[model samples]
Target: MVRCSHVHLYKNGKCNSWQIGKEDKKRMASNQGSSHLNGHSDIFLATSRDDQILFNGILFYLGQKYIEGAQHLPWWRTDGVILTVLLHAGPVEFLYYWLHRALHHHFLYTRYHSHHHSSIVTEPITSVIHPFGEHIAYFTLFAIPLLSTVLTRTASIVSFAGYITYIDFMNNMGHCNFEHIPKWIFSAFPPLKYIIYTPSYHSLHHTQFRTNYSLFMPFYDYVYGTMDKSSDSLYESSLVRKEESPDVVHLTHLTTPESIYHLRLGFAYLASEPHKSKWYLWLMWPVTLWSTMVTRIYGRTFTIERNIFKNLKLQTWAIPKYSIQYYMQWQRESINSVIEDAILDAEEKGVKEEGLNRNGEFFVRKHPQLKVKLVDGSSLAVAVVLNSIPKGTTQVVLRGNLSKVAYSLALALCKGGIQVFTMREDEYKKLKEKLSDEAGNNLILSKHNVPKTWLVGDGLSEDDQQKASKGTIFVPFSQFPPKKTRKDCLYNNTPAMLAPKHLENVDSCENWLPRRVMSAWRIAGVLHAMEGWNVHEVGNMMFDIEKIWKASLDHGFRPVTSFAESKAN
Candidate 1:
């Protein structure tokens, strides 16, 4: 229910709700209260939806069997439309207002209404998650208008269908947790306030528990003096467009073509997990192909998702280019333009710091004088790779395309008394030059020695895996994950930490990272803002690994093995 693909629920990052896959029961128990007791289960939501369909069917059957004018086929009737609206605005709203207030009384509230109130931050589906007894009472109350219209011979199919559609629209809109009802309408027509209630108004009913009891219309709440005192101000505050400012921006890009669907604006379910090639997604290849083409021509960076980490606002921005495009030699200038534009745009928006993926290093070299602090997060990533090496391991193979993190990881490992071996003489020389004389003593260049732990990076090949011993663990030091070459060997996820449970609106996974897990590159920008550090960690310079590691732990970020643990589970 939390991450259902509802249009009203997700637009503009307005809804403040989280859960997508399996419930983090231990983490959820601290906050969700009794709502954690099976109400949020997929089965409960499915059954609740089915029950409403069944209830509507029974109502139709009764009407066709007993009502005089229920089976009529006229499509439109002006008189019927007028009568239905009048009936709802008068009797339907009045009676339901009382019924709703009555349901809040202690006896009924405990048995039925509390279930609906459990979701303090609501979704569109939250409007229907109620006990069966409550559904029955609601169906009967709603049937008043239909029954009255049918008996009076003023009912038509349009009037009946239109009234039902209105109810569904109003119910979903009010619970969507986003204020879609523009305040300008109320300003233009002052009397419309009595007839319409905004999402903020209904939200108060759930939060305050006793006031603002009207359903879709606020007339009764005003008449009875039960409306919340802050409804108008709250509505105004939610609508005011504040400046576009964020504490940190994680600048990344799309990966495989299938990654198009993994964006938050894309499919909800796919976005909530690691990227995987799905057979069903192949059927959607045309759309994927079209999207890729569009991005190539568009050449801009756009926000894919947003989150609130503690009190800070976080955003993930994606350059229109894909990972494959970044590899193409001809696309370098175009790619640079897209990335530069994104950083400048972030700077213009008052972004304090911007985190870059590995490919973004080009911008640091090209535009060294830029104001916003740019971080590559190599320090934390190096720390993660070093700590991931199994305990009591004396030696490990370091392979693949040598990056700043890879070099730093090798040096740190050699410095710690663990022997670092490299098969490539060129990579060995590159790393040896950067190490201290004592640390360099542990670095060995050889092709014959086999180590069970291989610290790999980008461009790891199938041949590399074949040379390694069977069941070897491939731990990645690169921003992107290495392709799995041997099913017999274990692969770990890249450097990331399990995000705190309190981070709000984290409904999607970060690339291949698990639910609620954040990549170190992304987290580095956040740490920069939290620490109020003003330095740009670009090119060869990086923050102290120990300091970043300690800061991450202090902020409740627990280290996770790249992919080994997730694959095992």
Candidate 2:
């Protein structure tokens, strides 16, 4: 007769070498694997083929008893009863062993299995405390088996309810971290030694993985030849190495940018809905504000500072210490240099002819000829306007920072098609002095004049600055600097220009403008939805609007009707 902790073989005498250590027992309890050692309950060993037969026998008997109790029910009802019970009970046991093995076999152990092993030794509660997904899988296994066999719905329900209670109690007992069962029970039942599933057994299952696959019954494991009869030393060796820790796996990669964008859009839609009423909006408003504030503060204080430190650290520790002052100075100088280069480059690079129009609106030519008359009275020619030139073309305007590369990009754009307007002579000269001759030539200079609406600094009025930044009209060809005046500009007749709508007020630009714009857009979208429009309808409308907008660019006409037609089509 084999004992619970010791295997007594008739030929080899008593094999007492398997006595579990006190530390191991304690470890098992702490880990929640010690719940299987109750004397009042029957323990099933799944290590050997004989154990598997015994477990099956128990399952069959349980099924038969359930069927016998429901014999008075109709045949169809009885079938339903048996199916439901088997479905409810069988899967839980099967998956406990199966998923445990699967987690070990698959790479999911790093994330899924490590939680189970948090206990070096097992305790009773540890049996079922797992990731939600793992728990669901375990539940599904039992659910499917019981549902399939039980014919009567009520019997199935009763069996499931009982099975759940039993499983819960047993699993809890296994991880209780204490051994309260009597030793006499084990002494009387010699084969019970191999049968009783102990915390030591289950702890070894987690600690080693190669052995102890059984849950309530060890018979399944024994028949399947998965039972590891080896000593506890083997279990200790299989534990995850500290250096090869599973924490290295990152789960963030599962999320994608598109998903994040859509989620944000959904939030925006929800927050903006009018019918959602004021209370919900009020609840969410703080979250939005806090997120924005935190992001900005983090960027300014941490991200920017970290960048400064990284750049300066290679040179000296003094850099990070003086980063603030250094960064300020650097930014000022760079801005000044960029402005100068932009002016100079624009002057040198002749704006190229962008395109010609048969309508004869300023010949529709590119502006490539760029000339900068320095404040010092020296002038520089950057590049020739290769495209056709129109008569009476004077002054060029440029966009972007006054850096050589920016100037060069502008020049490239001019060569592609855009016209040059005017170059600020004094600013141009200062820029040339800072750059090498070769790089100076590459600087981009635009032929388009800075719209009066855009010139807000110093000499300009607040109203003028606001108009320049927010004006929808493009500056006319005749408004090129060095010749045009405020009086010469027409208010409403100019072509629509693209300006940063959020920068209308200088004081408020840093704070209120972005929030206001975002809020407005969200509100608009929500209001649109509240009008009983579906998401698909909204998406289609947006798509149509975009199509028309693009078509207008190519056809030289704002095709509103065409947009409607496209949406309909």
Candidate 3:
């Protein structure tokens, strides 16, 4: 009996992640052209891809169950394989070529084929989006090879499996919208072009809608005069295309060892949702250990995400070191080396702006001669925190490790006639020295008083959270979010905003931020490029808070309100 191994398919086969070609590279540089469908679509549109896979599975199951002499077929037979190939390259190819052309005819085109052609820019999944009736017709056409082998009692399980796998691979490759098939293959064997089709070949079929109608082979198209004239030129150009530099690059680091899987290159579903550690991941502890060891040994910067806004290309790169490494004194130099290399690389790429989180500030400060505008996004983050504060509040307790954002927020609050209280004498004196006489008067030292509003940052202690009254709001100005200790108290998300409607491919949430939301620090870099600000907003330097706030709104990044604050209001 033929033994079939249960196979679980990854997205577009195993090579999808590694085979990003020129066009695929371009698509990878932006989130706009991903294969994931939005949930807002109708039920049919949403589930159509899954349904197509199911349909194929049903066809295979029925063929095995009902066909005579199919169940106990041998695993391999040379004659069966040769016959299958000849039958497919002749009968199946010929039939499919004409059938595809007929689908484009006016009557069939509008009724069924148009659904498949709806996407001009195709992804791998786009190959399977035909209507149910079209699927039945196409499957029947493909069944020619399988049925012939079965009826003749010459069928082998390997022959059937190989044919189906070939079909699936070819279908996906043709619609991938990227040129991955190496030109060398065709050059070595000129006859292969007639037998094997490329992505550019099928792309012409979609764009022109009248030519290149051969299925997997161009022999019939050449004979019947339906071949596209520009096919070879397009393929050659796509092969020689060079990589383009992005306008902006945001540098970040892996938060946890498991956080590696949360990157877009890792798992699509996990990357899209808010990041959280799964309990089952421990089962792969050996793999995780190897990854962590490899990353530590070969620490280099790598691309994490790619995005586009307006006409500008933006990319997010992560330092190989995990978050814990950043805190180790021994790891500081290694971390600095990775960050400096990234900054220098960005500068070389003609990137106008590079954003670094708080961890990267040391490098920017140490290297004053850098030409690229390095921004920490402190101005916009401060703006987000200021706007999150509830109105009609006179006093706010400032607690946590004082970072640049926290310092700026305290000054802004004090200047706006709101009293700022600090529990630590050293923090109060440090803040007092920087504040103007008018703002300084508003800064107070107190320990026992409780205010409903608190502007918190990193290093916030559990004791501090425990002291807060019920319904107290904790608004963070730090790059990292503080741990939640009080359920009754409302803890706002780290400063972030809803992304503009035009932001495409926002299928994944940013860390803990909801879908279509971006952190203020990240957005600040985009704003700098959009406004063409020449000055670097690094170290203690900050832009006008009001200006930044207005610009964020003008660019369509809406302020995110905490649920607790919203409920209280």
> RMSD of each candidate?
8.3, 26.0, 9.2
Per residue, candidate 2 scores C-alpha lDDT tens digits across 353-395 of: 1100111111111212222111100000011111111224332
Candidate 2 runs further than 4 Å off:
1-92, 149-157, 183-196, 230-569
Which residue pairs show backbone clashes in model 1?
Answer: 492-562, 492-563, 493-562, 493-563
Please provide, for model 3 over 449-558, each residue's C-alpha lDDT reduced to its tens digit, 9 standing for 90 to 100: 66878898878899988888899999988767789889998888889898888776566667777777788888888887888776677666788888888998999888
**Which is superior by TM-score, 1 or 3?**
3
Clashes of each: 4, 107, 0
Query: How displaced is residue 287 in candidate 2, in Å?
Result: 51
Estimated TM-score for each candidate: 0.70, 0.26, 0.78
Give the runs in model 3 whose Cα sits over 4 Å from its true position.
1-54, 64-91, 101-121, 144-165, 185-195, 208-210, 218-229, 280-312, 358-370, 415-417, 424-447, 562-569
Off by over 4 Å in 1: 1-126, 129-134, 140-166, 182-197, 201-237, 241-244, 285-313, 348-350, 357-371, 414-419, 425-445, 500-507, 561-569
Ten residues in a row with the worst lDDT in model 1? 1-10
TM-score pick, better of 1 and 2: 1
Task: Please write out the lDDT profile of model 1 over residues 312-346, one tens digit for every residue.
Answer: 87777777766777678998788767767777776
Best by TM-score: 3
TM-score, structure 3 vs. true: 0.78
Q: What is the lDDT of candidate 1?
A: 0.77
lDDT of each: 0.77, 0.34, 0.77
